[model samples]
Target: MALGPASVKNEGTKEFDFTARDFERVRSLIYRRAGIALADSKQEMVYSRLARRLRATGIRSFQQYLDQLESHADSPEWEAFTNALTTNLTAFFREAHHFPILAEHARKKGGPLTVWCSASSTGEEPYSIAITLCEAFNSLTPPVQIIATDIDTNVLNTAAHGVYPFERVEKLEPERLRKFFLKGRGEQEGLVRVRPELRQLITFKQLNLLEGGWPVQGPFDAIFCRNVMIYFDKPTQGKILSRFAPLMKPDALLFAGHSENFLYVSNAFKLRGKTVYELNQGGAPVRPANPGKLEKML
Candidate 1:
């Protein structure tokens, strides 16, 4: 009996035969396609997320879906495959302390400040960067330029749309709400839109960090790559950090995720603050953190 789409059991809760080999194939493919390292623990997550792909293609098993993926590496399904597997947990002002440091940097750097929010999941992080710039410069049209990039095309589309549920921005100060977002009304109620002025300051693009070349120039004042390195192994993280280091000025800052510690991974930066690092000569000491948890993530 040949494995084909007809063999699929699309009934809800139907168990697909997901084997260890299937998991390893997916792990390797995602790493090659986008430089994300899936841990051994992510097996269930991998199955749960890509099971939808199986259903979508009417393919019964993980092996069939992965086979389809390998056969059509350039297909739209490949994009969907990468998107489905990529994690995207983000919010406005998440890791709020970073923004204050960002605001201060923008103020000191003066006009036309450049920033890159490398993991701009669901648009909030880049939009927050834009809002911080607006407040720092005190203008509806702030003198700042931001490039927001993400590996997942799905989230990039959402970021470009710049719409969010009402509750997403409710925690923001009323002043910021009035200044940067338009409350949707009538048919569009219960949602908010990022003000055009704020949107203008940002450019959202789809980029894979492991790509040989980026489409944008650098020498940026700051780069917010938070919460992303936790998904990669130390060597992969170090390679990414090395690439990021050159794009920034010597005084530039790199904001890392809460659980990430780059000290042992990359010697290009020194610890400046909690989860913050400044690019300097080399070999800067890392701040104290729970080494056990950090090692696991690294």
Candidate 2:
């Protein structure tokens, strides 16, 4: 999910000729493929990101590259194109306030906690959820299961490994850093790996919310969909929320990005707190409970 100002990279040395028609064609393709609505402000940014694809495939121009795509409906380049424009900006305990409420919700449930980090990027957000549950339950191996998912397979690959540079974790409180992560040593210095306990609590997968069917099964206690909806238009956001409503437990909470508000999108959810939503009583039709085994994920 892209945020804030559009990029201002110098366009003078661009290797490929990226025309307005090419840009519009790209906007249309990505919208239908991934439900992303590229703003006119993102033209410079689009050119910069997709240029690498042109280079990678040895295509000489944006027109030729897009032509290859229009010709082959199932080209692997579609995946690469979607990944290129997808922006993943996340940090551990990002939008930090959401964790405390999630912990308290788990406490009230009084059973094993199940969470879905629907936009987890590079493992940080879901790992943060795991750590919060561990602290709330006062054990590293608390009865918790987390499924971390993202549309970008590239980010999911990094997340599945549970590794990061030291800077990524340095701001975390010292005790949390010690308990939840293994700082690299010797040849691996300056890199950190999430403690295996935390890693085991999560299963990483690629999921497109717009896709017809989701592999996920739930009555999940919580769903963290922060920062993701901003990329989608109102209708796309509403459709995803409608799908999410059924998988959620009646009391389940939906944590959104600081910049997002779901109230207008669907009646299924109502704001419970700052950027947090819970099912509107009778606002959604839920699926039957199917509490599946977490071991299947491992």
Q: RMSD of model 1, in Å?
A: 5.8
Query: For candidate 2, lDDT tens digit of each residue in 1-298?
Result: 2323443344678787877778778888888888787887778878889999988999998889999999999888888998998989999988899889988987877668889999887889999999999999989999998999888999999999998999998999999998999989999999999999999999998888888988789989999998888988777777888899889988899999988888866888888999999899965553322333111000
- Candidate 1's displacement at residue 174, Å, is 1.0
lDDT of 2: 0.85
lDDT of 1 by residue, 1-298 (tens): 1223323233456478876677768877987787677766666677788888888889888887888889986789988898998889988999898899988988898888899899898999999989988889988787789999998998999899999999999999998898889999999999999999888889999888888998778999888889888877666777788788889988888998998888877778888999999886755543333323222231
Query: Global lDDT of each model?
Result: 0.82, 0.85
Candidate 1 backbone collisions, by pair: none
Cand. 1 TM to true fold: 0.89
